[model samples]
Target: MGIFERYAPFVQDYIYRNRWENLRAIQVASANAIFNTDDNVLLSASTASGKTEAAFFPIITLFAENPPTSVGCLYIGPLKALINDQFMRLTDLCDQAGIPVWHWHGDVAQTHKSRLMKRPSGILQITPESLEALLLHKHAAIPKLFGDLRFVVIDEIHSLLRGDRGGQTLCLIERLGRLAGVNPRRIGLSATIGEPARTGELLSSGTGRRTIIPKIDAKGVKWRLSMEHFYMKEEDSESEAADIDALPVLEEKTDTAPANADPGLGYIFEHTAGKKCLVFSNSREECEAVTSTLRQYCELRNEPDRFLIHHGNLSSSYRETAEEVMKDDAQCMTTVTTSTLELGIDIGRLERAFQIDAPWTVSSFLQRMGRTGRRELPPEMWFVMREDEPDARALLPATIPWKLLQGIAIVQLYMEERWVEPPRLDRLPYSLLYHQTMATLASTGEMAPRNLAEKVLSLSYFHRVSQDDYKVLLKHLLKHEHLQKTEQGGLIIGLNGEKIINSYKFYGVFKENEEYTVRCETQELGTIVSPPPIGEKIAIAGHVWTVLDVDHKRHLVYCEQVKGKIPAYFGLCAGDLHTRIVQRMRGVLQEDRSYPYLMKNAVKRLETARIAARNGGMDVNPLVNLGGNMWCLTPWIGTYPFITLERILRLKCAESLGLRNLDTARPFYMQFNMDADEEGFFEILRAELAKDIEPLELIYPNELPLFHKYDEYLPPELVCKGFAHGVLDVEEVRNTVARWG
Candidate 1:
């Protein structure tokens, strides 16, 4: 009986008022797998590792020894600032066990959701777009608010294991367990899960149960890791210009210099001043240009701005006032965020996090180094990287510093294979099957069409969606009425699918953009994307405003604060990377190892990109040439098989290797002008990949490539068959062109 004596005595007096002398091998293997099995647990430790009190102290000691008649733990969090940081750590461990710790989203408060729909017992916390607006407007109070629900948990279950909001949180936990018949028992938490038995079968998918993942030994963390390198300047050398592999690459630009003197925002404003940091920035326009260059280096050292600025386009009172001044442990402040403060947001003693550049995953560099060591410390991060100074004649792949060799191949693929990125579970999501078949026909309205294809094709994330591609997506959503057909044959929600399910952004399934909001007098500064004239200025959460008034039918903008710098937009920042982190950044420029947290200009820019990848052979040719009928290639592969080998060289081996002017820098290197050579260009890409080709014949003529977010209300032949069969990988570009013949 020693899992802290099976928890409940107010979870062992809240783990002895947080002293926790023992129990934490993930809270004694999550209280011996939720008090010895009814299966489905999965804790997967690390990130201030008491994985939410190891799945809530044995599911709140089985809800204080069998007490549920209603709401007995549901939780779910993928940010409403991690459900307001686990609702103040589950309201100080369920207010000494009288329980009742609710929370709902869109910044809660509808009279605290009519006092949790009038007495819905302990633990609710939400947000899969507020549990798809509580199963679409509290559809008959989900069996009196979760009947006798016995534990759902979820929280950052590796950011809902790959997209369409993790298949709309597994179709809202299988339509809230068949509308509250209640199955519950699933747990799943994470620090940065790669494959805990495939995300514990995506957290017990239809909860039949069988997921236990508790191998917790966890204690060795220690990572105050570093990496540095900046440039935006110093040039002239690769024998100064004149077609040195035809120049043009130079990058690093925060308007190239002087925002309190650049050197990577003055080394992230000198190690984020008196600490309690976070910095981050991988776009909300570099989190408002690194919070307006670290608040102009606190107004050029007159001090006091101590920075702050979160992202996802700000405003929810400027991201809950930078999440209440970083959970104010006497606010030494830092913020400058994006990836919205990475995730499991506790934000208290966070003494360091920085990042600034290289984070396009190893699960976002272990969730921004799990926001900073938290209490038993050792989880810090640093990174920074930056670029620019190249183009003298810049060639060997532009004097490679590709974000400091992609941050040393994302820290040597998690220090030599403790890898992270998993759960893509083969796509063909067909835009989350047209958003769960128009949210199961707007929450089961006029059903029938074989009960709307057995409630949206028996949703186990649409089992790779096929009932003949959902009967050609229900005959093109009833020939574009977005689903109408009724007269009792049924399948309702029409008039353009009730203006796309009566917006509140139709309870999200990701991808948004069309924002505006912004404001200034009476503060709101948080959303921007094409809202520039009535005065024109705009930035966000980090200074510069000006605009004054441009209602455009209440999309709003009205701004005022104003000063200098500008660039900030709310859209487009895509990055994919993973072909095992671009083949471990081409084996960190063909190895010569030496990475004890780099520095000294990232170990002299990774020993000059390993002597320009050994004099441009790029570690033995992925083709190079670059003079006459040009060349380049360098596959190393990722971003959708480098967009399926640039549409198999512009739709089938470019006019038989005369391959004219191709051009690409995506998923790294392409440049063209072929006229065949290297073994007649891999024998014309193995005879046009041996004929019968079809990734929709490398899609072209009248391309409708609207990649996801309900692919522009689908039906452009199911958005070109969900971008030619669930976003092109063309068998990882035909197994890297079958090892180039």
Candidate 2:
């Protein structure tokens, strides 16, 4: 029988209702993998390629065939918005079949969750944090809720592949299985996974079952792409105010919003009017800035405000409103968002997507692009790169438009090689170890130290963690009162440990700053890490608000709308970039062939940058000498390696090369003042690297770097060990530098 013949009647009706002429390729593959095999499955396909239904149709059929006594499926999503979206979608498909769908998260109503607990059946959708909470608070009820769980579907699994949260999810599944005495089949779903085989391994890490990534014929997409570059002001010989494209980026335009506006914003504004779109920003600050700027443009142009804002800091009401607006086919609006919207939420009929700057990775680039082009349309994205005009006497490195070049390189990487970033599986993850250990103790009350070690260490995520390192952590925790030794020679949650585990934030392994809720007369704008004084204005929700009161006791900021502009203050967000991207960026400058996506202004900008790069001989030399004792080194390595190189220059090679006043532009270049010439600098770098040095040598004497969320709570020795052994990629740096010699 065909795949359609295998699906339950309800799914067939739903597919027929949606007017699907034939089963998608993914549907057939997923049915064969799930219906015919007992192994785990990984569904890696393009966005909106029927991946969700592909996995669900067969699973639902199996559920209908022999109903389990408890919830038959556990659906884990990375975001509340995603769960909510899927909850609605699944409800529509499953209601006719009498399958109850329950979504649990911070935003979910408790009454609905209580109903699920009272009679848990059908599918339960939850986030990892919520799942963590479930495992912690309702440890005994796990069997009652999911004793017969037959499947565990992780949506957007690529988002969790490289982080502590991914490890946490794996641990949660394993712990739940042990508690419930069942090994549910695992299935992963994503549109941007690079290495499916390795990802399959990650998916099936704890489960003894092998993971099946079925072979599907890859289909080519005709992407509608354009990239433009604009300076904050036109000071260069080429004016940015002119026509920016040889061919209009958008085939059709709505009414012009602003004639004399910031060219980049104007370009976005002109194209987005009367159309449904998403404007993605790299940061919440930029999202707010772009929203307010575009709203102000509308007011100046005497048009109705049609722009919306959505980010993690925004209240659920605000974010949900934006989501609803985008989901409605009739409503036309533009929502400026961060990575929060980049995941797989079905925002219907999105005409285009605009990126304010280059995204951090190739995976991100693909995800943002995937937001559109649904319903058989071409994937469409317009990249808008903006920077301040270079000063007349600016350093040669400063003259290059890095964002523009980086954006182009990101596009080329996917265009030429169809390459996406693979998961970095070599991390020590000591911080996660600390988190899972405390969680296990809290959930189980008390256990022998050996049993505790076994439970925690047996997790595949912690294989890289050594017993000595864990011992050091337990000793430190005991010293700090985060743990206590029971009279039975067991480990238990101590007073300090209880305080850490009691908070809602402890359920998550990701880092979070102290946030204060911002309110304006019954409406919640959002949360901010730090609030300005009682009178100073803060920016959020696409508008500025003056702080009326700061209730430190309650962690609330009462505010009133004001007319001004202020940058939103969030804590420092570390950069995550691959070395290959930086290397591709250098190659972008050297290439003579023009990218077809470059707009006229972007073309001119690239020409200017290439001229400047050639004159400095940067196309050939990784080392460039500025006037006087100033020099810059472009290592073309990834983030961790770049950080390692910085430490090596300051801590190891500084004395030999007389390096001082060091600074960096991330994976791009490191500029400093040094007494040694280019040849001498290379000699010193080569000599230091030639020694039998380890990643530990990159650290300064007595310096303890806290790089992870739980690093602060770890022992100093363990923290140093984790940073040196897990975080730094010294071998990659050495390999790249060897070619330079």
Candidate 3:
């Protein structure tokens, strides 16, 4: 039969009802693979190009034709919001076909989950963390829950391909297959997969099956892109000083709005007035600040608040309200969000998206921008760059508008080559190993130490972990009472381990803070950590609140609404700037080229920076002498290499060169005092580069660098090895030093 005829009736009916003129290329290709082949499938296509339906239509058809004896399919996603969205979409389609669709996540109702448990049939969509909980709490129900599972659908597969979370997902799938005694075909779905071969390999890691990545021809996509830059103040620029004085008085755009508002916030307020949009910030703190500022603008204007906020830290009610408001066809609302909404969540018919600054990767930019242009409209994005105006004696680097150039680089990279960040597979994932070890012991009843090590280390992610290293970890666990030795000489979860595993927080592999729930007279205002004393103010829920009372024992706080601005506190957030972005930033300083995406203020700033760079001779020399033997080195590498080079100089070559007083501006430049002359410096660096030294030499002796949350509990040596082999880009730094020769 043809692809259309192979759709098992209901899919064809749904297609006909929707009046789709023809099946999307992904759908046509996926139909053939899922219908004809027994192999797993990896479907890569652009956003809103029918990838979700493409993966599901064929799987549903198969389920309809040969219904499983138990739950038929398991859909996994990285984000709870994405899973919820997909559940709604699939539930609508399956309602007509008499196939039950269920979602299991934190936000989902327990009643719905209880129903699923009662029947244990149809599709079960869940996140990895929730799956971890399921495997632990319902160990004996695994076979009954998924005995005849036919397929496992992993959505936004690219997001899970690069980190321990991905490893955890793969491990969960492998464990599930073993426990249920069913080998389900895996289906991977993604809008951005830079390296298909690597992703295919990831998809079929322990499945003992090959993945078929269908080749689909996609047409060109249209985009409405614009970038604008703003100084924090008008008088900060010399040329704009007169214009600033001559311009009209700064009046409140709305009567109730606060006077003297932030220019960038005002600009966003004006642009997103009546449109359904997403304002994206890089961190949760920024997301909260932006939401508060926008809502303040609405209050000042005497208008109904049209702004909503979404992030990982927010309560589920708040996030779901935002999601539902954004989806409502009648409501014109804008949501200020972080990456919580960046994945493939179907929020119907968004008009535009606004990015506060440049994202770290081209993949992130694409994902943020892809949130819009659904429902057959061209994607539209506005880049808003805000920075403090440079002082009269501003240095070369400060004057160069990094965010503007970053936006241009992201666009150009995609426009020219369709480049996305590739997966980083070669890492010693010790953190995840620790998590999986705990999870394995908690899920299973008891096992001998040798048997546990053999089972856990044999997994694909822990392939590099040696038995000796595992022995060390086990010894530590025993010493700390994380595991107990029974009379039979088998390992079982102990009291300390029970305390760690029983907490809901242990379900997630990622880091989390100990948050106190905030409320105002029974009205919840989300969560906060380390709230100030009573009567002190904080911003949350797009409004300021003053602490009324503190209940530390219950981990709750009572607050009353107030009107003011204060910085909100979340945990730390760090950025990883790629080497390519830093290189392009250097080009922006050296080359006299204008990018089309740059707005008026950004254009002027770039020109000024170029002049300064030329005068400073930054283009001609990587190292410049300040006075005597004092010199500064400008190496435009990114964060990882910068870290590696710093260590290589301090630990590997410092004694030979008599280097001291080293100060760095992270991936940009370093200034140091050295006794070695220019020629001597080069000679020492060359000799050091030529020698073969272990990468572990850079690790400080007796230092346990606890990067990931779980690293503190791991063996110190294992943590050091993980940092050396995985965190540091030693090879990149070596290549850079070789260029100096």
Q: Which structure among the candidates has the greatest TM-score?
A: 2
My TM-score estimates for the predictions, one after another, are 0.36, 0.97, 0.94
Reference-based lDDT, residue 266, model 3:
64
For model 2, the superposed segments whose C-alpha errors exceed 4 Å read 235-253, 257-260
The lowest-lDDT stretch of 10 consecutive residues in candidate 2 is 236-245
Q: How does model 1 score by TM-score?
A: 0.36
Clash number for each model: 2, 1, 4
Of 1 and 2, the candidate ahead on TM-score is 2
For model 1, residues 57-119, the per-residue Cα lDDT tens digits are 777777777778788888888888888878988888878878889899888779988998888
C-alpha lDDT of candidate 3 relative to the true structure: 0.82
What lDDT score belongs to each candidate, Candidate 1 first?
0.78, 0.88, 0.82
Comparing candidate 2 with candidate 3, which one achieves the higher TM-score?
2
lDDT (tens digit, per residue) of candidate 2 on 635-665: 8788889998888888889999988999999
Q: Write the per-residue lDDT of candidate 3 for residues 1-741, one digit (tens) a residue.
A: 789998889988999999999998899999889889999999999888999999899888888888777889999999988888898899988887789998998878899888888899889999999999999899999999999999999999888876788889989988888899998999999888888888898888877899999998899876767677778675322111111112332233322224666766666777776679999999877888889888878877788999999987777889889999999968889999989999998888998899998888888898988998888777878788888878877545566566776777777778778888787788888888888899999999799998899889988777788888899888988888888999999999877878888889888877777888989887777888787898898787777898889999898989888787777887766777778777767776777777655656767767876776677666556666666877777777878889888888898778988899989877678888898887887788768767776778888767777777688778788899999888888778767766652
Cα displacement (Å) at residue 720, model 2: 1.2
